[model samples]
Target: MDITHRGPALPLAMMLALAACSEPLDFDLRGRMGGSVDTSQAALAAVADRPKPDDRGIISYPNYQVAVARRGDTLATLAGRVGLPAGEVARYNGIQTDDGLRAGEIIALPRRVSEPSPATGAAATGPIRPAASVDITTLASGAIDRAPATPATRTTTGTTAPAAQTGVEPVRHKVARGETAYTIARLYNVSPRSLADWNSLDKDFTLREGQFLLIPVVETAPANAVAVTTAPGTGSPTPQPPSASAPLPKDEPSPAAMAAAATEQKKEPVADIGQSQPAKSSAAMAMPVGGSIIREYSKGKNDGIDISAAAGTAVKAAAGGTVAAITENTDGVQIVVIRHPDDLLSIYTHVDGLKVKKGDAVSRGQTIGGVRAGSPSFLHFEVRKGFDSVDPMKYLQ
Candidate 1:
């Protein structure tokens, strides 16, 4: 049998074989076997160490307060002692869910006390008890007198925590470790923006331990009800700070509730496809998928807009960004988060399949996934500025 000459396979094989036969260069290792990192600064100088944080009863800072977590002090107990919400306290310290807090670590408490508003003369609303600067260990020691106030048992004496109030004593609060504007606001039933404005702080509203802050209080009242009081000559008003033990207001709807209401309202009708603006033609954005919006974002309810389309349709990135995460929720819905410039983030949810992975760099119109199969086949889209969710319409072109 005669062997016939072929194209490039024979030459390629020979070249690979030759390359494999060559030996890699090597260097002698005897002299370098005992190598060690050198640290000879001043010969006798000690290594630098982080400055220790205060681990005493309570360390105060700007906007929040902190205490060294002691034995037998869980996050719940600590939060109660400070007259703040347990969940809010845990969140400020980066704890999620009902997990127990860490011992020996610093804990941030809310701004329970604040200065009286100049116009109101009272501490915003009703009297706020003294700031929560208690020693968690002592409070949690099962002593009845030292036990902190719980949500169910919180009380206000002399000056009550009714729907409305007036000028009270100025209350003060010391900042604690790991506290932020959002957590502090939640504890006091105030808006983070408002808190920052009251303190003349920037939008960032940063907080530090040991720093003091003037808490701005809000007094809520029935719009129709009018105050009927005697003339000033009768007697002086009672002196009490705003109620520190007051729980969340009943009339104040939660963020989720408000968002859910908005979602329900929008569900009545879908946006017209013809009126649906094309991302490519509009601003500097791309459509994640061609579909009609089934749901739009409602602040506090839905964080992203929902688009419904045919099953297996491609989902593209709305803008150029790096893939930050790819996750699936308990409902088996796939989500992809992309980090963009200027501290912006784009999120795609309810995706059926993904074309990219976490950390992938994609272009403005790159396909990230496909819409999952559903009765209507839909996906959720969101744009966030930093950690705050913003409306997608502002960025979607």
Candidate 2:
């Protein structure tokens, strides 16, 4: 498969539209998180009749969309989906990282910014003014104004709760004996204000054991397990090098994380997007020694392109960049890492007789290393951005 012809098919705009939907989706909001979503429309309808986007064309809680909190849903897991800082989520949302989340309680996704809300903050519950319209049209959108809503007095009785104005449905929770306001809030993974607003309880109201209480929530679920697929690590030339340490293991990137990050962070490969159009740069690029690609790159299968060549074949620089690191792995294979432009890194693994040292400036087509003798004479080439790896074919040319 000539991946140069293949490109990132997922457009950026479509993804943003999906994330901003107001209704519960039949799909997992974190689809790349690697799990099924509670997409049942019946289950969704029961979650809450989330208000329609107001005149400003903004969804409720402009900062976030809600989901039924599931077992294992934590601030950290939620942060992983969009690379949120865990500490900020904990402090701003008043949630403990280790606290267990109640199943079926409302939870919020990664809002552009974390802020206190009537449901979570000390503010009393009432109708909050709609947030500024989210103009997702511009790829360079600004941060959401996540200011807390004005507080309202708590409802005295359950007939018309304070949060009722916001259209948040309540769940019935029978307060067990000796249960206090704080204990009840933790059990449901909800803020005390949310619990009080639902039942219209006074801030200082005492709860009797076994008393029934209503908890408030936005339907949300546990963060799904992010699927990261790595190709099986093939052994390089054997025997330890006297000057080099053992080979350090490397992990390939997952297509799911890659795609999701592309959607969320706009780190998509900037390459020729046309499948039928030949690579304009491939002709200008230098091959890392001419060899047939033994293992082609696959999104969910292989991490990078593997080219098979004779032992000791010279491995040239795919492109000019700074020699970032010349390290050995546990297998004694000398791996050359080059820091390139555009937040990209090119890795030449399983090579020996390295010509470049750490911090050496190399030019394009420079001989940085050579294949090792007495082992599979193949070069493992990878391209990466920050933490996520991508197909080298996109940029090798």
- The segments of candidate 1 whose C-alpha lies over 4 angstroms from its true place after superposition are 1-282
TM-score of each: 0.34, 0.33
Q: How close to the true structure is residue 213 of candidate 2, measured as C-alpha lDDT?
A: 58
Question: How badly does each model clash, as a count of residue pairs?
Answer: 31, 15
lDDT tens digits, residues 225-325, model 2? Answer: 23345557954544332212113223323444334433422222222222222222433234655688877666433556778888878787765566655
Highest TM-score scorer: 1
Model 1, 1-397: lDDT tens digits are 1123666786577557646842221122221234332211111222121112232334333334454455677777766654568887766656643555444444555554332232333222223222321212111111111111121232356452221121222235456786665555545545445455444453345555654444554544224443568688897665332323333224333455444433432332222233333333546456788879877777544567778788888787787666666776435667777766655667777677687876565666667778888766677787766545678888875
| Model 1 TM-score (2 dp) | 0.34
TM-score, cand. 2 vs. native: 0.33
